[model samples]
Target: MLDLGITGVQWYARIPGTIGGAVFNNIHGGTHFISEVVKKVKVLDKDNKIRTLSGKALGLSYDKSRFHDFAEIILSVEFELFRGDAKRAKQVAFEWAKRKSLQPPRSAGCTFKNISNEDKERLDFPTTSAGYIIEHILKMSGYKIGGAKVSTSHHNFVVNDGDATAKDYTTLVKLIQKETKKKLDIDLVPEIIFLGEFWFGNVPGCQGGGVSSTPFEERVVWD
Candidate 1:
């Protein structure tokens, strides 16, 4: 878009995924959400019919959307944007990418969503960031179980130290959830999606979704 002098959606420049994934996840960068600029969407519905949907139908809110409930595939999207300085857009995107470069390479990015602002104030926490809580409050940066360890570079990231298994990953996540809940009465909900039959045990936020009786079935364990 920057090539055409577009500016509004530059917040997504550092996000790693397709436009469809951005809308489905309602992924946010800085303080801007991808949903903010979305004007319309074209989707392949469950019936395999093409349909146009207004942006409001997306049900977008902090890492959520109606896409979680519908068996649809996003075919295309329209965004409301404005003509702006391509030079500035490039600069902004470059800065965001530079910041993201500090994250560890062996991880799937942040493991948990930050606590809601309401929850932060109600619980008497210092900040809404989950990484802050884990690193500064819980002091669990570099905390580990099996081959999975919380990244010291970023506390909310769970990085694999060479030989991690699905079991190890889930186990470490559960431990973080348990500790956060125990210490602060706050549930550390994961932002990561789990597939297959990985045992989450007593993890609070995971639930089954997507199509049933097929490969897509149980693909997203987020709720």
Candidate 2:
């Protein structure tokens, strides 16, 4: 894992996923997604031939990569970083942690990406943040669908609240997307990964529901 030592920036603030998942999801926080920082990617094709792609060779946008859509597995990734002070970096990280603590514990983090700045400005949107947009629509601390609830602290996050089922979460996400589009004419995409059978069964437009036939499951469990 390559650390860019990004400090005092909201890019690393409150995002709950990892570098690998961020790469896979095309997660863009403040300025740009991980794709923007990628210098090169080493890939193994179907025949197991090792190849390297750099610059525009690897097509990327929104939370997607051309290689990510395929069967290729990322052995490791390299990122561009700069020298910085450890103390200042720690201070930034601490502030971020404090801010994130205000969010619900059961959340998977932001549920959507903001529309482009041009569109937002045209709509007279107050904030480009997805959480801000949801808050405006709901006009409450939280919005509930069955056991799932849009977090009181942050709207973009749908919290499990102990009683939420996979179905509840999925339904709530759909509702958020529908509302956002209806009101703002912008589509909000999910940031959290729907794992296991849920991915195939729940995700729209995916072929053959109820998980991939592959045996592998990619998850991050920090001790």
Candidate 3:
């Protein structure tokens, strides 16, 4: 969009979701969010009736929207954006694109939100760095369980090394959570949204890796 002189969507160029999904999750980067540009949204209610909602009716907020867990299907969205200098916008997009290109092509986004300054002080962590905790404290860079591994390129993500099952991902999540708690006494929460059943730990007659029929290695989509 920025290449065409659109500016509002520059912050979300890296997001892998559709327009509706972005609004549903209030997708954001730095100080900007999808809520800021959304003019309105159209959704299908449980009765399969179409409803037009004002931006405020969507109740968008920190990683949340009314459509979340409401079982409504987002049909479309309208955005209000302004014209900007294409040259300047392209420069910004290029910078963001450059930074995004550094992370794994396929991996969950940051495993956890950074601890707040107050939380950092309360936890006695020298700094509010979740990546620091994973790498410096847990020493888990490039660590793996099944097909899931901590990205050597970035400590905040778990890369699916092709053919990974949901179990592989969850197991890795558990490992990070477990290790962080054990080593730093701080609990790490995930930002990924699991769409289906996830298995953890050993269970009789159960294998946690939720393998798909065909494996794919593609641009990593972060949630």
- For TM-score, the strongest prediction is 1
lDDT of 3 by residue, 1-223 (tens): 6656778777666667688778877988767888998988889998999999899898898677887547688899988998977787677667777777787877867767676678688767787877877888889999988889888878888888988787788778877888888876776766565542242123332233332222111111222
Count the clashes in each prediction. 0, 2, 4
In candidate 1, residue 131 scores what lDDT? Answer: 94
TM-score for candidate 2, residues paired by index: 0.73
**Descending-TM-score candidate ranking:** 1, 3, 2
| Model 2 accuracy (lDDT, Cα) | 0.65
Question: What range of 10 consecutive residues in model 1 has the weakest lDDT sum?
Answer: 209-218
Q: Looking at model 3, which ten-residue stretch has the lowest summed lDDT?
A: 211-220
Judged by whole-model lDDT over C-alpha atoms, candidate 1 comes out at: 0.80
Higher-ranked by lDDT: 2 or 3: 3
TM-score of each: 0.85, 0.73, 0.79
How big is the positional error of residue 212 in model 1, measured in Å on the Cα after superposition? 6.6
Give lDDT tens digits, candidate 2, residues 1-223: 1155543333465567665565556666556566766777777777898877773666678766665556665555677655566567666656766877786787777766666788778878777778887887645347787889888877778898779987888888877777777877787766565654455543344444422323212321111
Error of 1 at 114 (Å): 0.5
Ranking of models by lDDT: 1, 3, 2
Model 3 lDDT, full chain set: 0.73
